[model samples]
Target: MVKWVLALVGYFIYRFPGAIAGYLIGTLIDSSFESNKKSGRKGFDTVFTTSRSQNVSPSDFELNLLSLASIVIKADGSVSQTELDYVRAYFVQAYGKERANATFKTFNDVIKNREVSAQRICTYLNSRTRYEVRLQILHFLFGIAQADGRVSSPEVSQLSSIAGFMRINQNDFKSIKAMFVKDANNAYKILEIDKTATDAEVKKAFRTMAKKYHPDKLQHMDEAYQKGARDKFQKVQEAYETIQKERGF
Candidate 1:
């Protein structure tokens, strides 16, 4: 009985430490792996900011869509060097060097070979990405169009078609377009003031207009009148934002 008891004690002692050591080793390995993976992901994200966007698969239909919009931007028989450069830069930023270059070549070839419909591109994008993503994509496209410091009519038309394809409500698209056009108006005139206006004067002008054209208050007016009021109000707000951006107010 004594020998048997001693043998059992010896077995328990060996197994217990082995189990504890294994658990400790497993936990350490797991923690180390997780930490390394997190660091790697952070590194990748940092690189991605500088690298071109390559998230979309080559087989995805958005590629053709983007190409068509770009072609339309240059449709006036005169694609400015600046515009071409902007397109190249954007693709590079989105896809990285090699892929971006390849995609650009494809874009060039596709634009020459076929006439892809802008509406179809938008529709495909809308079906692919969520509404919010579509909005962001549209904003990026707009940024590209404005990169040349001048937005062409074709670019505007392409954007309008994109908005329609994204299923952005007609009213919202109209509102946004009006805002863009009104913004192109003389900033000083939009504020109903001049460069001579003091900081206080600018602030007062903005406050008066913001309150007068508040969308909430416009609800009581006729729909058409309300839209007009809102557009005017947007101009005033944009004027203020512009001045703020320029540090004029």
Candidate 2:
């Protein structure tokens, strides 16, 4: 309809030689407007699709995280308010206050249903998320397990199972576990070194571990994941310090 009206207007104007220029000008204006309108609709569709895709990605990530947390919290055959509180604080710290309540509700729903498969969730995350990001999530799970000042055997087992499903290396899994399991006694274990190693060897181990677990290495990650890496980084630093202090280095 608009095109026909524009054509008729152009035709009438073109009938007067003096106004031929006017007809051409009017046609050009109409054509430009029509082009812009189509482009505007295309731009809107692109933005809408991209926005929806972005929203789905983050929600999937959050849901998977909450599911894994529920698995860890319930692994000990019971739940503690302390652990729940720690998880809530973790969510708030990672996503900010605006998302805290909604995330907690999702956590509650996952726990209440009791049907969420930790293996499946971990598998999905392992495939979709970056390797370092998955490692950070494992670090966060350990923090949750230790929130009550103790990491129970069942919780450790659950963690191990999750790591396996995530395809995390056995050595990497043990190194992260050492950071949280204080009962392991050997700071060397945390650094993935032998107790009989020379001072030089220990220093090298510390540096290597430090580089591997440094939060700065993960700065490009989501803020929450970077925060989780910070916890691991601190533990690695503590372990190195303890070894140095004990050995009089």
| TM-score: model 1 vs. ground truth | 0.48
Q: Which residue pairs of candidate 2 clash? A: none
Q: Assess the local accuracy of residue 141 in candidate 1 as a C-alpha lDDT between 0 and 100.
A: 59
* Clashes per candidate, residues 3 or more apart or on different chains: 6, 0
Off by over 4 Å in 1: 1-62, 171-249
lDDT of candidate 1 at residue 143, scale 0 to 100 = 53
**Deviation from native of the Cα of residue 78 in model 2, angstroms:** 1.2
TM-score of each: 0.48, 0.73
RMSD values for the candidates in order, in angstroms, are 20.8, 17.5
lDDT of 1 by residue, 1-249 (tens): 222322343344456553454344334433543564566522122211212343332224325535655655555555566666766766555445554554454345344444657776665455445443444455455555666775678778777777777787654454345444445435655556666788888899788757755656535322432444555677778778887777644
lDDT of 2 by residue, 1-249 (tens): 223433353345444552444344444434543564566522111211222253223434655777788889988888877888888888777656654555465236446445678877876665455566678888989989999999999999999999999888887898899888865455878788878889999899889988888888677555777777887778888988988898899
How many clashes would you count in candidate 2?
Answer: 0
